[model samples]
Target: MGRRPMPVGTYGKIRVESSGPKRYRARCRYRDFNGKVYDVERMGTSRTNAENNLKAAIRDWVTPVAGATVTASTRFRDVAARWLAELVRDAEREFRSWGTIDTYRNRLEGLVLPAVGDLRMNELSTPILDALCKKVRDNSSASSAKTVRAVLSGVCAYAVRHGALDANPAREITRLESKRAKNRPQKSRALTAVEVLDLLKRLDQDERAAKDDLPDLVRFFLGTGERTGEALGAHWPDFNAEARELAMSGNVIRVRGRGRIVNRGKT
Candidate 1:
């Protein structure tokens, strides 16, 4: 079957037209949810700039009337503060592990916000973000680069949700591959039964292990497959003597700036 035609006045019919020598004109037709259609045009010295101009124009057209209050010219740093506030609030209500929140805070404050926090939302483009991701991959580990990418994407998502931008520009950026990611060891070794028993016997004979009850804890961990934090959070009330059953109900975690707290397990 042939493809169906989009309705007239639909958003995102952007095209670039050759102007004078090496110059270009970018134009787009956009129709908002309210059925209002707008024709936008901007001139640029290069085709890339022309395309970017049209995308920016489309974003402004679809933004709600209330978006005018915040303005697309608002600095990303201000938006990042509001984004962090919302993240903290939701994390507290849902009992998310403090480590997760700390990771987000660290990636934003230490990496993403520091690099592009002062730019306006409309000023960001896929090429700009792609270069930043490449720089991060070169300067830091692959894992750190990935985390920073996630933080940047999250910030852009927040802007979209609040109508500061029409879409997340970060989504269109491609990540550079790291040598560590491609060539690192991929296998993990698990202890066999004999090794576990030997380890338990050694723990039993150690004086410090005896004081800490490490042998029993190791046995319990091997038997239940529960994480160390979850095991630490378990208590007598969570076990039933008659049924001989135990509930893996919660996890304990220590926050960086905050104290430790227990939260319900995901499973």
Candidate 2:
């Protein structure tokens, strides 16, 4: 199938016309949301240069200044992008893993952004955040709603820090306490010492279970209480035989398009 054409005034179209043996002209047309159209025609010694000139013009028109102060008309989408950028930078600097970045990106792009990305920074308010929390809680889990609130709060705080706003409206919003979460009973299934020993004996006797390394893995969990991913990500180097210590340094995360990735320690 053919790709859809770019909107009337939005950038991204490029046409090359030869001006000389080694010279070409790249012409671009871009339209803004206000229905205004702009035409940029540039001539360069090479086709690539001409195309790059057109792209640069498009970026100048479409991309906002990084970390710029928010104004009354600044859109939430703009601020959110900046906030996420800084988050990714900090995460990478700390040797943080891709899973952390992917989680935040998913929550923002899937849940929070759709609900309020178009709102102006100045338009954000406690009522707005309260309604957003309720909407997300109704459709998603309590944990998901809490993440959305955190993302919103982070974006608002970023805006305030950049002098875009005087205060964070999210700070004034009430906690998102879902009835489902509040009414749920706490459950724990700790194994007794005898039960643990019997399970290990049984697993050791079962050839199939032993072949799958289930016995050792189960023993590791019973001994450490570490999560499955954390255990899966553990390495021999992470253990100290002399000190009798183990480093809970990373977790296994399955990214959507990219299979499994080891996330740096939660710490």
Winning candidate number (lDDT): 2
lDDT of 2 by residue, 21-133 (tens): 88999997777555666677777789999888677656544323356666545799999999988987775675556776688789999988888999888777889988888
Count of steric clashes across candidates, in order: 0, 3
Candidates in order, TM-scores: namely 0.66, 0.63
RMSD of 1: 9.2
What lDDT score goes with residue 5 in model 1? 44
Runs with alpha carbons beyond 4 Å of true place in candidate 1: 1-69, 175-195, 235-247
Q: Write the per-residue lDDT of candidate 1 for residues 41-130, one digit (tens) a residue.
A: 777889998888777666555445552444466788888888777878777787565567778888888888878999988887778877
Write down the lDDT that model 1 would get. Answer: 0.78
lDDT of 1 at 31: 66
Off by over 4 Å in 2: 1-71, 95-99, 138-141, 180-188, 192-198, 205-211, 256-258
Error of 2 at 230 (Å): 1.4
Candidate 2, residue 253: Cα displacement in angstroms equals 1.9
C-alpha lDDT of all candidate models, in order: 0.78, 0.79
Check candidate 2 and list the clashing pairs: 9-30, 9-31, 10-31
